[model samples]
Target: MSIRPADSTSNPPPGSTSEATSEATSEATSEATSEATSEATSEATSEVSSEVSSEVSSEVSSEVSSEVSSEVSSEVSSEVSSNPTPNLDIREWIRIGTLEEIDKNGPMVVKGIVVFQHEGSLYAVENRCPHMGFPLHLGSVCDGVLTCHWHHARFDVCSGGTLDPWADDVPAHAIAVQNGIVYANPRPKQPKNLDWHLHRLREGLEQNLSLIIAKSVVALVNAGVAPARIAEVGIDFGTSERSAGWGPGLTILAANLNVIAKLDTYGQILALVQGLVHVARDSAGRPKRHMLQPLPATEFGTPRLQEWYRRSVEVRDIDGAERVLLTVLGGDASDADVADMMIVAVTDHFYLDGGHTLDFHNKAFEALAAIRPELRPQVLSSLIPGLGNPTRSEELQNWQTPVDLVSPLFAAFRELENQLGRISPATLASGTSDSPTDRNASSIDGSASSIEGSASIMPSQTSPLLTDRQTRTDAEKIVDVLLGDDPGVIVETLTALLTSGVDPVHLSGLVALAAAKRIVHFHTQNDFGDWIAVLHTFTNAHAVHERLKQSQNPLATRAIYHVAMRIYRDRFLNIPSAALPKSDAADRAGYSTDLRQLLALTDKQQQVAEAATWVAHYIDTGQPMGPLWNTLGHLLLREDAEFHSFQMLEAAIKEHEDWEKSTRSIAKDAMRTLVLAATRYLAAHAPTARELPQVARIAWRLARGEKLFAE
Candidate 1:
């Protein structure tokens, strides 16, 4: 997403959502399946610069066509019998807004998903408003409740349970994140849902057949056979039991000897074996249809000749197929390419989600790491496109979600490094390695034992820098330069760190730097939602740090608070116009608290002044300001106004003294601000001047001397 250049001297209107809905992916690409057209909403247009206003408006209008189509289908489908199963699985993975896209209390919609990120993980539910099927992505996240933007319905994201008095709960999807990328895999279809089952079956059949045919056509072409002749052969194989083996069986048997050796050593073989065993062993101890029937149907020929065959193949260990493929391809290919092909082949048979296995990924990383160190970053860049700008840190966090399944991958890379003699046993086992003296010789071959103890290698944790600050600066600089020049630097660095179990905060800091520069914009192609989210996260941590430091080391609080206030101001005042307006009273109060917290960054005296100013504004403007005004006014009266230490100590002796003093010290002063003109008018009619002063004095006595302004 691109960041718009705001006028440095002018603040936008309050409640304006100009930057909220950033222009995210110009084109959507699916993570699990082929691309699907994205549905953009009115909020998305809120961020359009005046220059591109017409273009965005036209794009939005175009989206209405799709909405109309969905509505028509929904109406028609409503008449049909209810189908509990999903019609589509593996729909495209959308670039949902960045962590910042959804405000603390705002709901963000991407495609048809209602998503919001809190802490570090993301939560998504179908966007249809549960009450009336209005889009919930336009809703709000308030005090852990997702309140629908339409009809005021509510749902608890943690349970997907409806809180609205009139609504029933709707379906929510399971969200998976890997390396800052967010994935939503719809809840699996129930077996009893026959309609859903049919849909899934049709989808699977189409996908499997397409893959099979593509491979078969490629194989036949390589064998110098004609397409018509291949069709004839395939037709014969459809019915003849012995000929059935000619398809997938022969496909696997094509691998050569060298490829077989690599397959034997690769860890993915274990993952494949495990998956195949599970898929083959259905719930009732029967084989799954795909596992047993290598081909669901074979249509042999055109008008002159026609034939069809469908049958289940006999049992055979999945490994046997792998062994055959390796034997055929090994001698003719390099280990890497051969391994890549083996992975593809294994992935197809296993029906894996990513079309890749953990071992293959590990092997890929290992291969990349073993090559020239300078080139490894480029390879990583392909895996993660927007790496350097920390805005994709959520993408990284999402990336880490997939690590559990991909952890064994590190082992593969480590083993590869070990084989190349680039990593020593000590480093592999303990994260501490002795340097080899012959640097060039050490990494040149499959094994370099000659410089075992002679090489000068630094341990992973020990950098030459002396102070944490220096190390941080160096790391930040490296990250900045890499982010600016190489797309993969951030991903590579972060992956390495995650694999090492390093603290995420360090990585978060680097990401914050990128966000600060507006490099990683995931909210939209032209938005800064991603940047804002990262900044909000970082500043929150800083705020906590300041709070902690106040107790442990008072000296650090001022600096940290200052930094936090700067972030809060930028985030709060600059919220994009696309952001939905706050509807819930409690939510607006929370926002007031956020502002108060920001104001607390100033001194005790200034804090009171600011609080008074805010309270006056709240009362006059009808803003549901926070509940801290009483305490702040108290502090202002005692500490600043010095109303307590007066010859009025005699008047303070009267029964109504507290009230009189409070009115004079607090109310009289609050009336002066231009913003409080309305408030002053209202107070004049509420109580007599004599009675108001007495009430204020009583409040001053009740309040403790500490600053009541801090919210």
Candidate 2:
């Protein structure tokens, strides 16, 4: 039988690890019954054969990826690790002549298995190297270990377990001899090892082993484990292992979780793997947290606890803040109280860490919500350190020099108390946050000062969708002023609205809409790195909007001030703002959309405008929103997107609903615009190395009993 390599063309060869998502075969197979054309494991091989991935051609089952990077260790290991009784029937077995004939030939390939004489016994294993799909038949067996010459990956001849973590285990087939006839079983019984898989997932996370994580996720998913449970393990490990608190990796994981239900199984697997691997990367090499405990004997009331928490964060006292947070949990601090306290701590600062502090706080809660409420303290405290030394925009030159945003913001915040009569937990979600400080240095002007004075940035908001200046409600005008160039007017509009008993939550959401407009209008012509600045502002604005819903904390309104100021600052990015995709671009809108056109656009880089336009056209026509989002979900999974891309997508989805629920004049078509924003951001970052999604596909196939090694 001709055996195909991993991820082969309509034929074999597969992917790369160190490999979050680089295996890029464009084919899918319903039944991969082909052989490796040239690519072998090592010189003897390649990764998964194109046959496997091209074989994937028949089943996008995942459309999950052309980035198939998983080692097909799942099936191979299932064979070696399981102990199912061999079938008694001989009809299904392949007879390889006699044992005497095997000894005379030294080793022989029969039906993709290499029958070999090792020591005094006969062992049969897959002929392809589980590492790269090279023929193991070409390898050398010594001291009972079969070593592939290509990568020097060694495996036990009898059990087929790999000696190297980088390489997956080679499958060991069951063999028996009757009347000197040696026969091998082609089908290996896959036992449902749910607990074992969970344990391995932890091992994968602990060791930061990508392939292990890949295999284990595929196995657990095959066992029908809830994705939330898998995410919980990663969250538990990620939060506890890293001392700095919830970082980008964990945030990305949570962000993806917000929309995991929107993805297909393939997309879901890819989304989960991307999130988990990021968590692993973040926790890797970082010292595990020392873990602060709640105060042992405190009779602290909610007021005192809130004050103590805020003071600790204020003094940059991480330890004190953690203890206070823990104390609240130890006592009867309701979830809302706990959330408000954290929100107050972060919001009091001017866009702390350029909004990361707020975003992280929100996402941590979202991560908690995704799993269980019981893991609250453990997840909540993970956000404390982030509040410690965040970059307070008030102290930054950008907020001071050309634009003195701080003094005015604090002044506007004076009426925050009068607006909120009741207290609530800071509502939340997650996002990326940074000023031009995070932009790459090579841009013509990727500097803090560059974003400071762009008068043109505010004018793009003149439209009703962006800012209904002529609209009736204070909420509507607040939206208009936020999109204006005058910082003083923006502050005055927000303050007067609050003083007039306007819901701070409703007002905060308007700022978020203005922030979203900044993104929807974000011009791709600016320094490529400048996208982060606008994204940070929007996500930060969105985080503030979410928290205000669950919280009546007046201090939380500062985030609103901070993001409004950030929106003012990011105006320059929209100097030549991207044009809104015309509603008339398509004949009529529908509930159905063809993903091929959209997917093809992502094949090349810098398709930001094209992608957003295409999505807008299809969506503007009558295409259903569900399938568009679903396809976008798959498209995102197929690429090696950065943390910010995930942030943009999730935040847009969450914010779109907020807009859709509104009966106000400003809310019209806001949902469509948010989708356009999401489309633009994703298009801006598409076509990365793409190694992670491939790994997801490989694991998925392995779990389904496809021998990628031989396919």
Task: Report the Cα RMSD per candidate.
Answer: 33.3, 13.5
Clashes of 1: 62
Off by over 4 Å in 2: 1-97, 108-115, 124-129, 132-135, 171-192, 372-374, 418-476, 583-593, 701-711
lDDT of 2 by residue, 175-249 (tens): 544334454545432222466567778878888887778877766665567889989989998888888878999
Question: How well is each residue in 324-361 modelled by candidate 1, as lDDT tens digits?
Answer: 33232323334443333322222111111111122222
RMSD of 2: 13.5
lDDT of 2: 0.68
How does each model score on lDDT?
0.29, 0.68
What TM-score against the true fold does each predicted structure earn?
0.18, 0.77
Clashes of each: 62, 69
Error of 2 at 83 (Å): 10
